[model samples]
Target: MIFGKKKFLAAVGDFEKAAGARDGEAAERAFAQLYQAAEKAGDAEFREAGPRLAALLPSVPQGPRAAVAVVTGACVERGADPSACAPAIFAGARAGFEAAADFCARWAETGGGELPEPDDELTDEIIGRTGEEPAIGWFTLPQWEMACVAMLGHRSVRRESAGTAELLALAERVTEASGHEFKCLTYALRVLDDEPLVVLHRETGTGYVLRMTGIGDNFQLHTLLAGVLIGGQHVPGDAPSAQEVAVCRDAPGQVPTQGSFNLAGPDGAWIFNEGTPSDIPVVDGARLLVLDPPPYRRGWPAGRFFPGMPGDLVLDRVLDEAEAAEWFAKVQPAKG
Candidate 1:
């Protein structure tokens, strides 16, 4: 088969035009011609063609999901790298009228091939990698969810969920289901009446304010403590107590440079680091709560669980002292 660069480019142009116009029949015809040209092209020509084709993805027009699947399948079959295109493909599939999992299933049917399974390393690179617009979908792949559970303290995972509601929810679910530390639970805290909370950070000379604007009531102290202590893992019928926690009612309006805190309590349970527990003078308001660790496994798994973060906690953003204070002030003013 003789490959003509001019003809291939022309076919691509025509297909893009047809797709943009939402002319399914015309798009399909143009795509067929485009694929045929690609098929006839030599390896070098195909390699160059691959990215051009993939770049067309995350298709602009939501005309035919199957057609997008066919284009992707052709690229993979013809030796195009899946990673180069998978993110866009998956993003486009979900933005369409189908769930991402269902689109993946459709991809298999159309391509007669399986999607690449992203491992921990690759998942790190792909999930919420910066620079691109947020994909219009939630995390559906179990591999993605598990990776989040394992790398809850990772910066990419935290940044991805901090402002995005869907990803934030996924982060919460992953932490709860795996009995890992709930790192993103604080992001769920809403301001009492859509007012932003501003607090000064004690550590830095420069001052910046963190802003959180939402209207909802904060969770109860006991409920919040239970979520942190036991997560989704506890005895079948036994409820855990939030009483073993030491409360510091009056703490200075300062926070660590990290947006959130996870440290070992005096009793060895992980606790929220509001201030120095040992030396904090008795204040009138309860600002910090140092909780006792859960009891030895009664009905929980007995195997040695891999600790991802400190007790499988997620990493918070590193902020300037003032920034941290403002951040905490916005999302966690309910502590006051």
Candidate 2:
């Protein structure tokens, strides 16, 4: 709203005062205002004070959650370019938080060999791109670091239990709001659920197994981008042995225990089992033990479903009530 020198200084003062008091929420609130003022500041004003503002963000009293969301939302509210401020925000944040540490372990790859510093040509090219966020992701490491930090920060603080569709929707919202298509980060929040994710929604628990396929969805990104977002992961649809699958039904007659039938090879009973007009007639009291990751953590980024990473998704059992509860006991639910 055309914030001038006086308003900007006042907002900064408020943030410092709140952080000094160890009032994280209040500090974040003040930081939100400061970020807004930074956006509204004129070209000259931003050039003059942006560096100073950026220098201060690392030490700001970041709250328990949504610190990145708060900053992005402020940029969205003012219709400011998120890239304009991302560098400073991230440089100050990467080492300051634990969630960023977790994210780095998974995503901060030294890929394609060492990345050279972005020269003016590169910066200008980024600024000229139709969709890329300038000086942010895919540019400098600091901006990339910032993007990841914010993403994890949002996850740590997010209070919503989202499915695949809902997470995609939020990604769209963040893009519309901040003019930044944070594809990797936004999608990761929903797909990964919690980092080291381990939970299930009843709707998706069944759908997850039902939709589990080996690979090759027309080599498309949209079809299974969620899978890849959690980690550079893959889930094998290879079924356990017949001996492994032979179920010990608890009851003699109880609506053929709803489950995913895994077969021993690429072509077998499992595929035909899902075929039309009943081949292997189902009666009552059958058991199914589908071992896969929780639905939220099932996506394999970049279509990597085989030759996967450690801890991608293994032994995630979709057993009957008694067995499911037992499996849930061994894994500790993730703590913020």
- Per-residue CA lDDT of model 2 for 178-239, tens digit only, reads 34454444433332321221222222232121122222111111222222322222333333
Best prediction by lDDT: 1
Give the clashing pairs for model 1: 152-314, 153-315, 249-285, 249-286, 250-285
Against the reference, the lDDT scores of all candidates come to: 0.35, 0.34
Cα lDDT of model 1 overall?
0.35
Q: Which residue pairs in model 2 clash with each other?
A: 227-299, 227-300, 227-301, 228-300, 228-301, 234-305
RMSD of each: 17.5, 19.1
RMSD of candidate 2 to true structure, Å: 19.1
